[model samples]
Target: MLIGEVARHSGVSTRMLRHYDALGLVRPTGRTAGGYREYSADDVRRIFHVESLRSLGLSLQQIGRALEDPAFTPSALVGDLIRWTEDRLAREQELLERLRAIDASAPGDWQDVLRTVELMRELDSTSAARRQQAVLARPEGESVPAELLAGAVLAESDPHVAGALRWALARSGGDGVAALAAGLRSEDAGIRRRAVLAIAEMPEAPGAVAVLGDALGDPDPTVRGHAALALGRQGVAAAVPTLVGMVVEGSHDVDAAEVLGTLSQDPERADRITTALAGELAAPTADSATRIRLIQALVELAGTSGPEILRRLAHDDDRVVALVASALLRVLEERSRTNRADEDS
Candidate 1:
């Protein structure tokens, strides 16, 4: 076949076929009457083979080695090509994600586009400080999309940066909650913990309470604890059970106690809180430490009703518990007297 015919047959341009010949990748075998290059069947086959290898992302030099060097092993070159392709693919995928985030932000001009791009870069920066600045550096009237903020919060390890991201998400109008909710269901325990922490910071978010309510049953203690504390502060009575358990286990018991006390302002919830604490204290298998922690929480929930529980604990078998409870009882008595005096005045 002539070069033009070959180009027509193989879908390769004649110019490229000549280039292939110059590179010794595929040389025509004979000359036609016009002294033009004419390809034999084997030459056309080689041209097709070179095109096939090129399709696999082989460079011309590598293709030459693949076609001509009998001693050359393709395994190493193929592995290299695979790695190169994977790297290119990763870059493309990352770019696609950045574009998606920017598009989601609905940038109105080149400045907005640049701002979104810079923010995305900074959010992924190695320096935690840069990531934090990216979150806080929002231009007036412009904001980072919540999905990006949510993604950053879930992956952020630095406490300060994570806090800033959470703040940003909270103010982003709750669009990120859906994304953060997905993180709540992540199999990675760390991601799940971060998700709950971020969501807990956005109590005003739409459906934030419901998302947190689901996290109350998270297998991870940290997740459940944070969810319980946030929900308790939000006045969700469902958190009362976990808040009471936190007191027994000594995990954030102080915060849990304070939240429980706030929840107890309602007469019904107050009874439930008091009853739950007393029941845990009376468990036959309750260890001394657990009982002691529970006692401290009860003092935080101090009222006319809990003095009886404190009085009983004051004389208990555990000397430490007795001493702590007796001290708390005295403190509770002092506060009660002061309140009565004020009411009389």
Candidate 2:
């Protein structure tokens, strides 16, 4: 086949075929009397081979080496090509994500588009300060889409930036609760914790509350603790058990105790909270430290009710528990006496 015919037969263009010939990659076998280039079957086969290698992202130089060099290994070259392709794919995916975020912002003009892009870039900045500023930099009356904030808050690891993001999401009035809810169900523990924290900051919406309630049973104690604390503040009675557990485990026990005290404002809930703490104290499985923490939590419960548990614990086996309980019991007794005196006066 002649050059034109070869171009027609294979998708390779005539100019490229000639360029290949000039590089000695694929030379035609013969020429006609007019001295035009002519291709034999073998030459056409080599052209097809070069095109095939090019489709695999091989450069012309590499294709020449691959086709002519006996020592050239396909394994190493293919591995490099695979890596290059993966890098390109990763870049494309990142760009796609950025575009999606920008589109989600619903920018009204090119300037708005640029601002949203800039905001997103800063939100992902390595500096926590910059990420925080990005969130606070939103122009008045310009609403950030909740979806973007939800993703940022879930992935944020820096405490300051995460706090700013949570505040921003809360101010958004639970618009992103659905996205945050998905984070609650994420397999990543860090993500689940972030999700619950962000949700806790959100305004009380039925959807957000439901997600928070479901998180009460999360296997991660930190997640469960955060959920329990949020639910306790929302007056959800289901959080009582987890709050009591937090007190016994001494994880955020002070905050847990405070919320438990709030929950105990209800007479029925107070009895239940008191009963739960006393039960944990009596558990044979509870160690000395756990019992001590539980006793401290009891004191933070419904007013004078703690003294009864304290009096009982004062005679406990653990000397530290006995001493701490005895001291707290005395304080409660003095407060009771003072209150009675004031009432009589």
Candidate 3:
């Protein structure tokens, strides 16, 4: 029978039949040479499963993924769906309470309007249970759903949520780097900060690099700081360009310079490294503290490069500066002696 006949007999819409067919949920018992769908009794049963799930508030997309392959565990989706529905109910209840207000004509107020705005923003930002459930409703291989991600941002106010998300991106067997990166733009500063940290820790993925690279430019200093540190962790030479830009922009020159030093053995960019340290040393806003820290770090890690830094600080006019410089030089000298001794053995 054709789809219209299946719709009449099974009481499932022809559109749904087409969608289910697309999902491999129901195939015609046989297709006409012309490719029109021809359903059988088994097809009707598949449609029943799909319709039943949809009626239960499962989106068509979710129902198709579930019943298209019964192996698709509904358990995978239930917890997320419940959270989304509950959140919606809570918002509606709050709206209803406002509507019952006696003095204000029971219409929309500024608070309601603002809440709605936040609701929309949340739809764009994170991937909490509510957010992720919606993503699950999307077609397989589809790019991430923005609204679904927004709900995840709402949960970011809780530090534990942000921590979990960070850990998930870095540690979980899931796909959510993009979802968490979306949190960086959240109106909530703390959420953005935590999101950056999470993004910072994600295993090196193509999108992860780009997302964290962009985050390094976040208007928030804390976010920028986290981004700088995260990119350094990846040790990708590509991040060097973005880090350089941040320093040039004055977002955090000292940190950027330190991170540049942290870049993997980019012996080819020795000049850039030299330029960065010189830039930091010359930055008018760069304080004595930042320079001292940078020099100490360079002395500790850069081997031969440490000599110049030690030379400068050890001989500086400032007595305190010279004392710290002398200490670092002694440490480096002792290490050199140890290495020479090991060689003799």
Please tell me which model should have the higher lDDT, number 2 or number 3.
2
TM-scores, all models, native as reference = 0.77, 0.78, 0.50
Per residue, candidate 3 scores C-alpha lDDT tens digits across 135-173 of: 334344433223223225434565554444343335333
lDDT of 3: 0.62
RMSD of each: 3.8, 3.9, 19.2
* Model 2 accuracy (lDDT, Cα): 0.88
Task: Give the worst 10-residue stretch by lDDT in candidate 1.
Answer: 296-305
TM-score order of candidates, top first: 2, 1, 3
Spell out the clash pairs found in candidate 3.
122-150, 123-147, 123-150, 124-150, 125-150, 126-149, 126-150, 126-152, 126-153, 128-152
How many clashing residue pairs are found in candidate 2?
A: 0
Candidate 1 local lDDT, 239-307, one digit each (tens): 999999888888999899999989988888888999999999999888999988888888777456688
| Candidate 1 accuracy as lDDT | 0.89
Residue 185, model 1, lDDT: 95
**lDDT order of candidates, best first?**
1, 2, 3
Clash count, one per candidate = 0, 0, 10
Per-residue lDDT value at 113 in model 2: 89
lDDT scores for all predictions?
0.89, 0.88, 0.62
After the best TM-score superposition of candidate 3, give how far the Cα of residue 137 lies from its true spot, in angstroms: 25
Estimate candidate 3's RMSD in Å: 19.2
